[model samples]
Target: MNENRRWSTRENDRVLDEIAKRQQNLRKTIQLNRKEESDSVCLHDKLMSEI
Candidate 1:
């Protein structure tokens, strides 16, 4: 019974770790998308100015 409890705890830790990794990746992706969006906006403004 003790062994089973230990296994369950390990499983929970593993799941939590996976969730943390996914969250980190999602944050990185969001940051990159925002940067790209801003860059495009800057480019658009530049083009408009030229015209």
Candidate 2:
């Protein structure tokens, strides 16, 4: 019984770690997309001002 409990705990830990990693990746992707959008807006404004 104790061994089974230990195995369960390890599996839970691994699942939690995987979830955390995916969350981190999603956050980074969102941040990157936001940055790209802001940069595009800035470029558009600059071009409009020149014209």
Could you give me the TM-score of model 1 versus the true structure?
0.57
lDDT of candidate 1 over 1-51, digit per residue (tens): 999999988987886676567656656667758776566557556754764
Q: Which parts of model 2 have CA positions greater than 4 angstroms off?
A: 32-51
Estimate every model's Cα lDDT from 0 to 1: 0.68, 0.68
lDDT of 2: 0.68
Best by TM-score: 2
RMSD of each: 16.9, 17.0
lDDT by residue (tens digit), candidate 2, 1-51: 999999988987886676567556656666758776566557556754764
Q: Cα miss at 22, model 2 (Å)?
A: 0.1
- Give residue 4's lDDT in candidate 2 (0 to 100): 100
